[model samples]
Target chain A: MNFTRRFTLAGLLAVLLPVSATVAQVDSLPSWNSGSARQAIVDFVGRVTREGNPDFVPVPERIAVFDNDGTLWCEQPEYFQAAFALDSVKAMAPKHPEWKQQEPFKSFLAGDRTALAEQGEQALLTLVTAAHSGKPTDEFSKSVADWFSTARHPRFNRPYNELVYQPMVELLAYLRVSGFKTFIVSGGGVEFMRVWAEKAYGIPPEQVVGSSGVTQYQLDAAGKPSLLKTAKVQFIDDGPGKPSGINMMIGRRPILAFGNSDGDHQMLQWTMAGSGARFAGLVHHTDEVREYAYDRQSKVGKLDEAWDEARAKGWTIVDMKQDWKTIFREKP
Target chain B: MNFTRRFTLAGLLAVLLPVSATVAQVDSLPSWNSGSARQAIVDFVGRVTREGNPDFVPVPERIAVFDNDGTLWCEQPEYFQAAFALDSVKAMAPKHPEWKQQEPFKSFLAGDRTALAEQGEQALLTLVTAAHSGKPTDEFSKSVADWFSTARHPRFNRPYNELVYQPMVELLAYLRVSGFKTFIVSGGGVEFMRVWAEKAYGIPPEQVVGSSGVTQYQLDAAGKPSLLKTAKVQFIDDGPGKPSGINMMIGRRPILAFGNSDGDHQMLQWTMAGSGARFAGLVHHTDEVREYAYDRQSKVGKLDEAWDEARAKGWTIVDMKQDWKTIFREKP
Candidate 1:
């Protein structure tokens, strides 16, 4: 080998090695010291979680709760739970005569999202009650599974399950690795969300609490058994009810909370009010190109009250356009 | 050092090495080869769990459940739930006038274990109903917490929390490590157990399924919020109820099960019958010296039909006297 050829080959190898190292670094989260906002999350979590630290929480008390809809997922255009109810109303349209002429029901059946949206929270509640109640809990769950298998997000053109933010998915896994028992406290139907939560979030059904209707168990003449759902509303898991549900179901206050709207404000407040270290983050949807983006004044997933409080309370505002490098699952 | 001295030291080190290796190996579970029994459990679980693994259960279909009392924890001398009821009755004696003359309450207040035993399941149910009913779930939890703090097991003279078997604790942790979400399905009062389950079992109260009394949330005078318990019997979490509760609460069949008596037989059978790899183990209380020894005909923690079937069904029989080198938590 000539000396000039050897020198050229060695120089090329040196350049390639540095390039590979930079690529590997890009694949992981950037350095925690990058900014004060990211560092706040890291510092609070680290101090409270470190053994023997003054603010160190016991393992049993290491509960971290998150709002499922717009916190860990994309609830744009419509909330996912609302979407489930809308689809259910459509699917069950043939079975009921009253829904054919019902205002919200007719709008839901006709796939008129604009009309349904105008009907507001009360209409959403009516839709949810009609679809979730008056059937056996198991049967309702089966219907949800069937619907999830076939339904795709209108804008994303992907199944609702695939529309979950990849960044939030990583955050859930990261918290679990750090010994926090993550729970989904949402305003969605409890039985409905529980059906697919374990697989999608790695959180068990029992850990996923939400709005619930009354349920009863009974036996048939041949001794066959089943669970029956009644028209009675047991609890509405939203606003202040989110914290109450957390206290009732988990029996502990959360150390960290993630939310997006005023509905989750109470939960974040309750979490942050705890004495030790805490974290409260709000996701601000600001990107319109890669994802649907609307916040403050949006009818669905409104962010006005929470956005003001996030700034006042010093909560981390995750700018969708800047903070996240990716959104949904990578296309194969 | 001289050659002879050095040789003697090397000889001693060789002898000590094997003993150290043996101790380390014994600290972990024995490397038992997969036999027919173990294979049955593995195969059933694998089939139900594998993605597209034929028996590939969907997320909603991935419901695995379990029983508490004799199944997950040690229940001897009397059911732990019953013990809690008895203690509550005694503590509330000063508040209730009828208890002084009530048959079961009198027996409980007098600390007459024999009298309570003579009354059997019917009398015990009456006692549980009287003590556990008629209060909001939260208030009932406070009562239980107060009782548990001061109550000591009659035999061990230790708090009930300290009486839990160490081996069973490890098994629960191991199963969780293997992707199984455990639940406590028992004939015990739900409100009573749920209060402290998180602290003791690493399972939140929501995951606890047990016998329950009907409760209603209402506003008291001055608009104070309260929950009122009714006399209505909601559900009995025992025998067939165990499987039923699992289906209703978790919406899934467990791939693994553990129990010590006939009350748990149906649960084990249900788990085993699921189409895939399943594991069923029975804890045989054979250690008379370290713990109580009773089986086949004992009034409490009885083992009879389940014991005979366990061997025939190829369930692992955990011999408490032999299998565990240590039973309870090591004293600090």
Candidate 2:
């Protein structure tokens, strides 16, 4: 039979499949399935992906925005970028004396994690700015590459890059295969994210939108070079800023959004508000053994109010331990 | 017969066929039987696109970057963006007294194209900056959209947006079908190109790199509104800047580069400088009946030095009047 007839038959079969049967079938879906979460994912994927379904998003409109740090990857102990910046500060400390005297810089140099936390967001910003500032974008990129090559996570004892969640990687690839253009919309520095995102996440630099620092291009007798100045917050890519960034950068509202904390709550709200077939997923760090737990009270990647709202909104809550077969890449 | 027997029969037939007869058969390609230029295109495409050819580039790497204004569309009396800026200045003139007193602005208001040209690049920059600066990006986008909707090309009497070369549009789409990512690297403002590029050219905004203005996000005390400032020059996407912009923005060197003037000669050179397979083509305006034909002495989109260099480089020169079956969309 022709495509139209085949599609019609498929549509009828889908309607005839009882909901209870579908739920029961999903419940037996290997050890990788848990709660109602796996069912929600499969059901959403099935309906929108069905050929003649009313909810089918055309390939062009199937854009999905994902928060990188905690959503797509493990951002525990601290955000991976923050950890990168912290190590960068220590590595470059011998070259600059001013950092030794500066408050947050001094605390960082002293390896005082408690003191660094005590300094709060402003202190973290200072630390990032001190390490990431003053160099050309290319030079900073080289530094990041150099550091990432050797840097290992203190607890995992693996290279920081390798600590990216394997399950999320598979999900990203799956979405792309299903005609979604995945974008990393994060609060990290744009230049900082671009340097590693393509290699780690398979998302290109242009598709990554984030907070950025002021940059200037200058010409001397030696020709032109783009220089990065001290971090004066250019645009913060978080909360409502995520939607604004999506508008300015992608110029399209995403159909799917994934987040792990309240920082990404506004993005999810904006995406879910779109009048179309949409999906919102929240990652709940509920496994204390495989990965670090304690979400509501965690200093970083906190899942407070968003967790309750996600439950009420029927957003898929990915229970890390139960939903994932493997947390990171398998050892050779 | 099975595949092995068919392949053997084809090999035997190839050997049995007379060499001179085969040469004659290949030479009888419909367009090639008529002209050498047509033959060149057919031969080049066949050789480079053949699956087993040594020079064959994988479809994924078959990126082609084209200069927009004169290469793919007309830019006669002035650059289209320049014309847009002039119309915008006129529309905004009632609100500003400063423009009436300004030198280049006063000249623009007086409607003298000669005076505007005499103002040179600096004067043109001033005009563009004055017209496009200080507005929010969205407001500028809406202004561009509104202006494009009503503005007509003086010669064609068609909306400026409709004046794109039909042949080039076909070429872009054809290349895309054959696995090429065609990008528009223009001298127009990046934000300006972004507003309508996807709709007009099927090239996403992320694929566009052009001259840019500084932008900043600002929030009012009432927290009611935030805006993106469009101000002084951020980067000029022309000449040496084109290669740098492509590298910094796209992160990949194009295998094919097309241009119509000297400004694009550098871009073509950069593409040709790549180690492996490459192709460079120049769109020569030689049809006065269907389109404007000035080349050597044209003030805008001048083509003097590039003409001689293209010959030396063995780059294909498209004769507009002779080669194209159609010009603008409105043409018969």
The candidate that achieves the highest DockQ relative to the unseen native structure: 1
Chain B alone: TM-score in each candidate?
Answer: 0.79, 0.84
Alpha-carbon TM-score of each model against the true structure: 0.66, 0.71
In the order shown, the candidates' DockQ scores are 0.15, 0.10
Cα-based lDDT at residue B311, candidate 1: 85
Per-residue CA lDDT of model 1 for A189-301, tens digit only, reads 77878888877778876677777766655656854455577777766778867766665456567888888888887788777766778789887888899786888778777
Model 2 lDDT tens row, B139-182: 88899899888998898888777888776776675455445688
**In DockQ, how does model 2 score against the reference complex?**
0.10
Tell me the docking grade of candidate 2: incorrect
Compared with the true structure, what per-residue lDDT tens digits does model 2 show for residues A49-143? 65567787766777888888787677878788888888888888899898788898888888888998898989987878878778766688888
Evaluate all candidate structures by whole-model CA lDDT and list the values in order.
0.69, 0.72
Error of 1 at B46 (Å): 12
Local accuracy of candidate 1 as per-residue lDDT tens digits, B1-332 = 12353245433332333322222232222322234433444455445544545665543344445566655556777777778877777767899988878888888788887998899888887887777778866677788888788888888887776676666665554334334566777777777777777667666666777776555545456434444666777566776667656654555667777788788877787677656566788778888898878889888767898888888867878777776767775544
